[model samples]
Target: MEIYGCSVTDYSDRYEERLNLYKDKFEDRDESIFLEREMINFKDFHNVLVSIFNCFIKNNDYHKLINDPQFINHLNHLQNNYNDVFKELFQIGPPLLDANKNVSNPDDIKNEDNRGYIFYFDFTKEKVDNLIVSTKRILKYLNNKKLRLQKPRTPESEEEYKGSITTKETKPPKPSKIPAKWHALAYLIELKSKGLKPPINTEGAFIKLELEAIGRIKTGLKGQGFYREVSKHYKDLDKPEILNKSFGKDWKDTILKLFNSNIVLKEYIDKHY
Candidate 1:
């Protein structure tokens, strides 16, 4: 016999004993005194069981029970035993989106369906577009400059070579030999001060910063590849709030002034070119 659809095995021994006593005294015989006592015991036991189950289910740690098949099965059995109780206590269906709408077609409605509506949120793509443009310009400049620097070797006859024993100048200018990493670090510092979040990888961030600096110094050193590379890393950092605040304007002016100071750029040109 089941009370509230729960089998005898599901209840504690005391509860089972009280339930059995109630059934035997109330239904099979005319012992009203014993029946009343056992009935009250059963009701108290059921309420205690329900309270304990409610506490367990409401706990945040109860989510761990999902990893145990036995626990999950036991929970399901308990749920079935007190289906009406459970239904009254918690939501049993998919979540609602806002008070008026159900989230039945989340994927279908996600793509601009509510665009232009006051309830819909839209992002301005202007900053991303400008980043793409500037990145491309810088990259193009770098690639072009690299190509131009590749010198052609002239072949000489053995007699001419022997007659002219002068040593070929292969030493790079002192400024060109200055590590590109330093330039990159300077640029990163400037960008950071202006609220841009630079890449966590120091080497990668420095390389990109140096490329942009190089592009600024040489107008003809444009390459789409350089732009794409720098833009890719820059966007990955994703601190667009800094750019949106027009900090790049001041950064650009400051970098230009430093470039013209003949302290860094002059040194680089003398060594490299």
Candidate 2:
């Protein structure tokens, strides 16, 4: 069963282990040198640090860390000296939730089946507020450097560059006729006036009149041939009704208008000729 956005069956013991590690590190202030030595990579070190930090934040006891004079002094020193490094290291992204609404343990996401829960941090919330502030400051500095490197351009030179490129104008292709029922004949006529082509089929006419009982076409004899041609095509049309049903009530009119319009019909004639 799915729970917390992930399958419950996929939950791993690693999640519990990570959670316990955070609890131990924060609650006991564990200062084991082995922990530091074991974290050989930046990723591993960041994970351990963020997990412990989150545990403290989530527990709503920020004072515990703040009250420690040494930790406070270290935090202040880092903010002043290596602020960029601290932001990069501590900006944890959004927590992944399982189908059961439980925050996914980062370790569990290493598996392929559980990968979907991993997402970038949502900047609108608490996860990256501090990080966002730091990023903005870094970006401002970079922008100033970029402005220094930029060179001014003359309008005459810009116009010459643009004139060197050529553009081609091509006509759009004509739309195909769609067949419909005889009860839809009037609708088809309205479309024909607008330059649309509606393909009528024999079988569809019978179905529309007998089964669907759509109203009959009321146009004069001059338009009879066009209606009959469409009806014949409708009977012969090979596609499924379910697929054609989505064409909408006025689709026949739209198609006929496109078929009758010189702008559209010219393309069809050009293609065939």
Candidate 3:
């Protein structure tokens, strides 16, 4: 069954076949129920991962499946299927917070009784924390690798002639524009990593990236709404009056603070402001 818009077919036909075989041979006698049962529960990001992992384990090729094309396909499909889910998680209110009202450690947040919003995903806990931490690690790793691969190549300089030809000064490379939502999420991740809770109701929350602090702001009713809100804020940030009201007159310096963490956002601010 489809879960978060992903089904067994999305992983791979072969994997689905194998899953069916296992369902027939091992646990469920009802093929329809086994095939159609929901695999992901939005309250717990770990559900899909665990279900997939179980599938591999059932096939007795769990170790060999690493880096396998089909396995990667499954992960990619999972990522694609859960894209909206990720967006929602990043945008919503009642962020996970520790007893000190700071961002809670992923490990500490694993217990079902935790007072954080994430606890609603799976009441059982059950590796949910690991899923969150591992997902961040995997995303960061993939994002960095993608950045490296997409970087433009510089041409080799011609050998300088002795006092015959002058070489022109090379201009500094410009930063590419990353999605504003991406930069915002990255900043949020940075705050979480540092044990800071992102606030859910403050304007100019983006400025917190500069101060290495987390400010409050309600993202919005949905991921798209939140993105639109932040995008508009980012667009209007250049105004003197808006800056004066949201941040202090020293907003220029405050804005520069974001540059320290998110290079692409800094570049965006520089190019726009």
TM-score of each: 0.19, 0.17, 0.22
Assess each prediction's global lDDT (C-alpha) against the native: 0.38, 0.36, 0.40
lDDT of 2: 0.36
Q: Residue 148, candidate 2: how far off, in angstroms?
A: 7.4
lDDT of 1 by residue, 51-90 (tens): 4344344432322323345544544543566445334322
Off by over 4 Å in 3: 1-49, 55-152, 159-242, 250-273
Per-residue error (Å), model 3, residue 255: 5.8
Candidate topping TM-score: 3
Error at 145, model 2, angstroms: 6.0
Runs in model 2 lying further than 4 Å from the true structure: 1-59, 67-74, 78-141, 144-148, 151-273
Q: What's model 3's overall lDDT?
A: 0.40
Kindly list the per-residue Cα lDDT of model 3 for residues 88-153, writing each as its tens digit: 432344332113544333444444534443343333223434454454443443344435534555
Minimal lDDT window, size 10, model 3: 209-218
Best by lDDT: 3
